[model samples]
Target: MALTLYIDTARWRAHQQSVVQQFPGIVPVCKGNGYGFGHERLADEAARFGSDILAVGTTYEAARIKDFFSGDLLVLTPFRLGEEPVPLPDRAIRSVSSVEGVRGLVGARVVIEVMSTMKRHGISEEDLPKLHAAIEDVRLEGFAIHLPLDRTDGSDAVQEVAGWMDRLNAARLPLHTMFVSHLKADELARLRQQYPQTRFRARIGTRLWLGDHDATQYRGAVLDVTRVTKGDRFGYRQQKAPGDGHLVVVAGGTSHGVGLEAPKTMNGMMPRAKGAARAGLATMNRNLSPFVWAGKQRWFAEPPHMQVSILFVPGDAPAPQVGDELVAHLRHTTTQFDRMLDH
Candidate 1:
């Protein structure tokens, strides 16, 4: 099999429970490589969460789990006016996020995203009136708003949301539901209290799935292990490991999100680099490989390839032989796996 994602089933179940407790009537979102567990698998899990509805990133994503999920499926992406929209399966709900897409979804069950954080779809504030007029017949599941977490207080959030609600209510449009993202609990509570007439739906992904680190881990089987001299030539580029050590080849690489992006910084610091430097100094000035051996980190021989990662497991560490297993932490959305074993 390819790279494997191991989910602590107990922890995942508990996390789901926590999410439901916080936001009752949870609409579990399952989209984009199923966040490394595959779309269909997530759909099945969401079904158990008693969530009869789910949000998907695209039509292709929706197609992946239509059979698995008997509930209403909402496609977040807007289809083009002239382009033939894929026929959503029975009971599927589509989100029309554009002005032009309104008429095309005349008889379809759909939601309309007002303003989205992703910046891809959704009707502009100026043109929303025209779009609302067009969508008079289609059953609007709700008005979707993908909010970004800001440092604002609860009062500020309530005021902003109240203003938005005023505009929606002023349009003389029938509004019932509201789907939001990235909002804090306090803010959501404030909004709920302020607008008791509207049904609130939180479209959470990251904080729901990967929120608990102890619940998730990735693993691959080591295919080979060999001792190498300082100058021993190995790997695709004939790059040397630079030190006497054992070269361990594990089944994971860029194809599984390993060494895929250059680097990403959060808030003003290069988080990856900072973490790396800290670990290097505190540990052994060591670089991390795509694969970890014997509970300790190793160094990659070179940049990762499609499906395999070469690591220089130090000569001193207990080396893993062929068919041995290796483990690593993975960025969910970026990684794809052949199997997701829930323990």
Candidate 2:
């Protein structure tokens, strides 16, 4: 009846525990659909993981999960002036990346983010002195550095983090704890070895929850199945069927993040060519669906509707009956499931 996310609870929990054990002082990041588990659910899981600090993407998210987590909330987004006011608990630690941000959040527990190679947010190195001066009124928790995912430029994350530590030491700033992102376990270990005094807590999300792909499965329940001839017109746009087959209506559509995809970075020439081909096909309204039938991904009869998708199951293949569940390959971060069942 719905698009459901089924979890192998035992395997999933085992993976989580393994990650927690691997990364000492790991701050479980519960943000942005909670990596497909929802924020409140992740909050409870973080509690079960015995994490003292939970990192959320925004202050409003911190406020939402406060009752469920009962631990310190670290807001990753830098707090800016004149932002929508949200009543957050005292345990919410604001991340301030600029002098103005520090001044704006006076008396609030704060983490100063230094500009990383990513260049997304954070105070520049030259502004470290100014930020140091502005943080007198606020409770400075520590510093944070968000590293870029691609290290293809030969830039080592461990070395980069060490360079920041050196800069902080030279600037006479506190180096008690440094929260970092996008660092591998070995990189984190090297940092700990280099700076034995500083506690480096990796803010992990995807690796912690979605590390084991085999532990989770997505299924779209078959709502209806109608047989059609080769030239039969069907669907909203009255598109002609490519051949004789069964039109399988599955319970997942645009609302469930079906038929939607994030922009992919097509780096090489072959990828760009493939992108062009996909675009060319899209113009003709001939697109592939994510729904898998009989171990094969089926084609969409037309663009998916709001609550259901029509997959063309060719006559040569076995057609699924109504009430059956079709496996769907979906991006967890983008998907909104009707239910998450744990076995």
Candidate with maximal TM-score: 2
Per-residue lDDT over 248-301 for candidate 1, one digit per residue giving the tens place of the 0 to 100 score: 778887777886554544554577678768567545424466567777777777
**On a 0 to 100 scale, what is the lDDT of residue 143 in model 2?**
95
Tell me the tens digit of each residue's lDDT in model 2 across 1-343. Answer: 9999999999999999999988999999998898998997898889997999999999888888898988899999998999998999899999988889999987899999989999999888888888667878999899999999887789788989899999999999989999999998888999999899999999999999999999999999999999998999998889898899899999999999999899997788999999999899989887989999888999899999998999999999998999999989999999999999999
For model 2, the superposed segments whose C-alpha errors exceed 4 Å read none
Clashes of each: 0, 0
Quality of model 1 by C-alpha lDDT: 0.76
Model 2: C-alpha RMSD to truth?
1.0
In order of appearance, the predictions have TM-scores of 0.88, 0.98
Worst 10 residues of 1 by lDDT: 151-160
lDDT of each: 0.76, 0.92
